[model samples]
Target: MVYDLNISAGELRASAGAADTLVTDLRPVLKKAVDDLTAASSSLRHWTAGPRMAETGEGWGGALGALRDNLTEHARGLRLLANGRDIMEQEVLSSFKGW
Candidate 1:
């Protein structure tokens, strides 16, 4: 197995910036989707369902809620990765003192 790693400070910064932008752009959309799903789930309580159908609706709502939570967490992780890269860039610059 062979591994080739090549990355400059400017590239790191640019990639980090792009990641930050992506996280910023997606977070709000994900948040709104979560909110909408929660609202819809709440409204589902008003609908009349048969014994089996009611259980199905409950399961569906739970799945939506879980998906929303996962998306929210994913956004958070993306932001963290971007920020960590930025921090690492700073640390490298400080260590070199010539960059």
Candidate 2:
């Protein structure tokens, strides 16, 4: 039995690039959303549910932060994988130089 494995470094790099672009584009939007939520919560301070709204906003901000961090790490991992694959491929090709 033989198993074939194929990995495309270019595709992995492209995916990483896309993730990076998404994070870049999303950063400002996430910040604005959190800021808006905080502002809204502040404006409702006199209401009975003001504190609850603030708490909910905080939770959402935290979740968004976590999502951003996870995506960054994913992009980093993809880049590392692509680099490692590239290095391995170079090494393998060089091994055949004498043949």
Candidate 3:
């Protein structure tokens, strides 16, 4: 059985661009959320649940940071894949040029 793999470098690059944009857009929003959470928790410091709230905010911030990092890595991987695909396609075409 012959199997064909169809890959579009343009689409891969586009997806990578989209991921990059998402990360960029999320940065400020994430920062604002973390800052707000921290401030809110500080205001509640006199309450019994203040420390817990702070901890929860920290956890949320860490999770958001991890998500941003993952998205960045994903975009990098996609870009690399697109570059590799373009190279492979070029090599294949060059090989067939003399035929």
Candidate 4:
């Protein structure tokens, strides 16, 4: 899963004084949030909304709960990513002086 985020690593690494700090600060939170979302999405896959859905009734409820948790975490993760992006945009991609 972490491998998939490689596309944005340049942006994430741009501001860090040391490469490890970037991983330290960002990886844990991002990992958990993504994992939660994945679990939620996976749970939802087994849900059947119509009658005779009993075959997966527990999964349906679990899916909803997982989705709820994922939604909440997703919002927070987005904010962190935005803040990190802003840091990269301002510190790494800019001269920190006006044009």
Candidate that scores best on lDDT:
3
Candidate 1 regions exceeding 4 Å error are 1-49
lDDT of 4 by residue, 2-78 (tens): 45554363453343324344445555665565555556656665554332343344455566556555555555565
Give the TM-score of each candidate. Answer: 0.52, 0.88, 0.90, 0.36
| lDDT values, one for every candidate | 0.62, 0.92, 0.93, 0.54
Clashes of each: 0, 0, 0, 0
Of candidates 3 and 2, the better by lDDT: 3
lDDT per residue for candidate 2 within 7-83, as digits (tens), equals 69999999999999999999999999999888988999999777778998899999999999999999999999999
Predicted structure 2: lDDT: 0.92
Work out candidate 2's RMSD over C-alphas: 2.4
Q: Which candidate number maximizes TM-score?
A: 3
Flag the better candidate by lDDT, 1 or 2.
2
Query: Which sections of candidate 2 miss by over 4 Å?
Result: 1-5
Candidate 2 collision pairs: none
Error of 1 at 33 (Å): 13
For candidate 4, give the lDDT.
0.54
Q: Which stretches of candidate 3 lie over 4 Å from their true place?
A: 1-5
Q: In candidate 3, what are the lDDT values of residues 18-83, reduced to their tens digit?
A: 999999999999999999989989999999778878998999999999999999999999999999
